[model samples]
Target: MNTISYRWMTSLVFVLFAGLLGAWSAADASELPALNITQVSENVFSAIGATAAPSRDNFGHNNNLSFVITEGGVVVVNGGDNVLLAAALHRAIEERTDKPVRYVINENGQGHAFLGNSYWSDLGVTIIAQREAIEEIKAHGEASLSQMRARMGPVVTDARVVVPDVAVDDHYVLELASEPIELRRFGAAHSPGDLSVWLPKQRILIAGDIAFHERLLGIFPDSDVDAWIDSFDVMASLNPVVVIPGHGHPTDIETLRYFTQGYLQFLRDEIEVILDDDGGLSDAYEIDQSAYESLDTFDELARKNAGRLFRQMEEKLFQ
Candidate 1:
C-alpha cells in the first residue's frame, strides 16, 4: 500500500552494495562435494548441500537445499538452482523414500526456484508458486535461465524448465496424505508475494526467501521494508519449533526473529549513520565491508547479517 520513497530507495541501494561485498568476501576457491541429507524428523527433513561456489569460507552452495518424502507423495519447498542440484535433491529424497514428488511450492520467484522446477515437473510433480511468482518468471524466467545455463555450463543445455501450474494469491491449505499444510501469504516482504509453508502437526515452518539463518540476504528492490518487518513479526508469532529457511540449516522461531529484527535493526542503524554523514545511498553501495572487520564470523552471524542489511538498504527500485 505504501508507495516507494527515496528513504526506501536508499535502503535498497545499501543492500545491493552489501550483496556485492558479501560476494567479494566469499573465498569460494573450489566446488564442494554433493550435499548429503539426514532425517531430522519422522517424515520431515533438511540437508546441508555442496557449497554455493566452493572455496568460499562457510559459504557453500546452500541453495542446494530442500525437504520432502510425504506419503501423500513428495511435497517439496524451494527448487534450488540447477538441474544437477535438483537431481541431487531428488536423489536425496529417494534415499529416504521412493514416494513420487507430488507438489513443489516456491516461496519466492528466484532463479533457484525456477531453474530446477522442470526436473520435478518432468517427473509429474505439480509445481506451485505464488501468482506473482508466475508473473516474475515470465518477466525474468528466460534471462534467469540464461544465467543458470551459464553457471551450470553444459548441464542446462536442454533443461526442460517447469513453470508453475498452481498460482496462489493469499494463502492455501491442503489435506495431503493425512497431513495438513498451510501455505500462508506473508504479504510483500522479500517479493510482492512471499508464502511460508507451515506444517501445523510438525510445528515446522518453511519460510522461503523471507528468512535467512546466517547467510547474505538479497533484498529485491520490490520488497516493502515496513511490511517485511511486520511479516517477520507475524512469522515470529507462529512460535515454530523448527524453521526451515529458504537457505541455511534448520532453525527455530527466535532465529527467524534475529533475521527480521536483529538484521533489519542493524540495517536501520547503519542507514541512519549514512544519512547523518550525508553519505549518499550510492556511497552505502560502495561501503567498505571492513565495517565488519572487528566482527568474528564464527562467534556470531554479524558479518553476514551486516551484509544482508546492507543489501536491503541499497536496492530499492525493484518492481
Candidate 2:
C-alpha cells in the first residue's frame, strides 16, 4: 500500500479503539443506581436521598451524599449507607470530574453517614469525622452494620465498619483549591457528633443531620432535644445561603429552620405543656403535631419524637 493509504488505515483504527474505550468507561460508571445530583454551587454538588426511612428499595440510602470539587481533589460528605451505595456515589462523582476523592467526611456517626467508610478505606481515602462521631462509630459501628444487613439484605453484605482516619474536636479546615471547606461541630443535635460543612467563600453549608427541611427529624434515644435546639441556633448563626440537609434537597436557611429547629422547639413546647399537666408518655404521644404533619416521615417520627422529648424533659425536671 502507498504511505498515504497506510497512514489513513492507522488513523481509522485509532479512532475506533478510542470510541470503544469511551463506551466501556461510560457503561462501567453507570452500573450502579443513578444518584439524583443537583449542583448547588459552582463546585459543590448534592445527591439528595429519599425522605423516608431506609429500606431495601432505597438500598439503605435515606440520607444525602454530597461532594465538593476543588483544585486539589474532591471532598465527599457522608461516606454513604453501605458499600454498594458508596460505590454508586463514587461513580456519580466520576461522571462529573476526574479528580480523585481525597477525603470522606462523616457528618455524624449514624450508619447512613459513615458505614460506607469501608469503601473509601479500600480506596485509601482519608476519612474525617468529629471526635464524638469517631467514638460513636467505635462503639456502634458493628451494630450499625448488622442493622444495614438486616434492612438491605445482600446489598450491604460488603459493608464493614471503618473508623475515620482523622477526628476533629470542634473544627477542621480543608484548604483545597480556591474553596475552603470548614467542618464544625456546634454541639449535640439530631444524633451524636452531628456536624456541618461550611464553605465561607461560597456561603453554602452542608448542614448534615443538624438541619432537616422536608422530613421530620428522627429523635433517636441518644438525641438531646434541648442541646439540639442550642446547636441549631449556633448553626443558624452561620447564615448559610444554601443548606444541603441530611435527608432533603438543597434549600435555604428559613426552610431548614422551620423544619428542624422550629419542629424541635414546637415539640418541646407541647411536651412542656404536657409535663405541666403531669402527663405521662402516652399523653406526650397524643400531643398535637399538626403543623409538621406535612413533613415526610411524620407518621413514623412525630409521636416517637414527642414521647422521647417528654422523657428527656421529665428527667431534667426531676434531676
Off by over 4 Å in 1: 1-33, 50-61, 276-278, 282-319
What ranges in model 2 sit over 4 Å off?
1-31
- Candidate 1 lDDT trough over 10 residues, lowest sum: 23-32
lDDT of 2 by residue, 9-118 (tens): 53464345334434224323245567889999878999889899888778678899999999878999999987767878877887787677889999999899998887
Q: What lDDT would each prediction earn against the true structure? A: 0.64, 0.84
> lDDT: which candidate is best?
2
282: Cα error in model 2, Å: 2.0
Kindly list the per-residue Cα lDDT of model 1 for residues 114-173, writing each as its tens digit: 677866665556788889888888788888777666655543466545679998987788
lDDT of 2: 0.84
Compute each candidate's TM-score over C-alphas.
0.75, 0.89
